[model samples]
Target: MKIHSIEAGNFKLDGGAMFGVVPKSLWQRTNPADSNNMIDMAARCLLVENGDRLTLIDTGMGNKQSEKFFGYYFMDHIYDLDSSLKKAGFSRDDITDVFLTHLHFDHCGGVIEKKKNDFYEPAFANSTFWTNKEHWKWAIEPNAREKASFLTENIKPIEESGQLNFIKQNSSFATQNEMDFDILFVDGHTEKMMIPHITIGDKTFVYMADLLPTAGHIPIPYVMGYDTRPLLTLDEKSKFLNEAATKGYYLILEHDPNNEIITVKHTEKGVRLDKSLTFNDLFN
Candidate 1:
């Protein structure tokens, strides 16, 4: 199996929101913020090519929202889904499956697109969109806290398209039926969020998703403010990190701007960032 780093684009998010209760002095050292208190973020997606199936995991926030809506995030267009796919020697039509980690806008927005005459449809018509039944329900009936992130334009179209499918949900991990990977279901970030654990050769590459957005979040206390259950997140992080450190897993971060893949070690301060490597450095 081959893995490709599909960079959707870059955007800026409030550093305070990203780091939660952590002080700026602490987080800023790793993810330095601008004068506006905004930190750089990447909608870094992943593509897996195994046999005849090409699976794209998480499409970055697609350019379908209004300019006013996008202005809030300060999006940079140096890299987008199309160009990144092209660089990977593929196209949207080539995607046979789209495995969404969750239904958050940044992660699933690129799956649907806005078209002429105000028509909305699945961006990858040839692909079977994947999400868990629990998440699909939670997203469609979103709570006030996460309503803004679950846009109607980004979601409704998938169900309407008749191409949406759900991976069977289970207690902790779910076995992916089609893709060559097992899923780790996490809830602190969102309901039934599926983090793919793909084994390629002798190494295991985990799509970190929001469970560990960046290497800076290696500390158990450094949970994102966006997480609904911060306490649950702390517990989840502690358990996952210890296991990952023990197994030597290469974590593929989705939201980290500079660092893509990171390895953690069992340090006195708990599991700490051991090394930061680029996608090419390891995968290539």
Candidate 2:
């Protein structure tokens, strides 16, 4: 199995929102903010190539939204999905499965594209989109707080295209033995957010979707404000970090601008950042 880091471009998000209760004095040290208090973020996706199945983790925010809508997020250095895929030596048609961690606009938006004047269609026509039934229901009928993040243009098209598939809603960890990966379902960030635990050779790479957005979040209390259940996040992070530290799992960060992969260590003050490494450092 081979894994490639696909860059869908960078955007800026409010630092305050990224780090929930952590003071700016603390988080700014790690993720420095701009004049507008927005910090640099990457829509970093992962491409898993195992045998004939090419699976993409997340698509990043697509280019279909209007300029006004995008301006709110301060999206800069935009890199569309198609170009990113091409650079990775593949194309949309090459994708066999799209495993969405959640259905937030920034994560799943690129799965569909603007077709005509108003029509939208799935970007990867041949790929089977994978999202859990629980997450699908939560996203489609989003609550007031998260409604803005779940855009119909990005979601309805997939169901309409007849390519949408749901992973079985298992209360326990769901192992897709066929795909050679297991999913760790987390609810702190969103309802039933599936974090892929992929084992390549001797190492296990856990995709830190929103569960642990960056290495800066390793300190346990640095949960994102966007998380619905912050206390649950704290509990989840504690358990996951301890296990990650024990097993030496390489964390694949999705939104971290600078750092890509990191491993944590069980410190005296709880789990803390150990070291940062690149993809080549692990696979090459």
Note the clash tally of each candidate. Answer: 0, 0
Q: Each model's C-alpha lDDT?
A: 0.90, 0.88
Q: Write the per-residue lDDT of candidate 1 for residues 1-284, one digit (tens) a residue.
A: 68899999899999999999999999999999998999999999999988788899999999998898889999988899999999999999999999999999999999999999889988998999999999999999999999989999989999999998888865323234333487888899888889899887678899999999988888999999999889999988999999999999999999998899999999887899999999879766
Residue 64, model 1: lDDT of 90
RMSD list, candidates in order: 2.0, 1.9
Clashing pairs in 2: none
lDDT of 2 by residue, 1-284 (tens): 68899888789899999998899999999999989999989999999887788899999998888898789888874676788789889999999989899999999999999978898998888899999989999998999989989998898998999999888755322234444488888999899999888886678889999999877788889999999999999999999999999999999999998899999998789988898999888767
lDDT of 2 at 188: 94
Worst 10 residues of 2 by lDDT: 171-180
- On the 0 to 100 scale, the lDDT of residue 211 in model 2 is 95
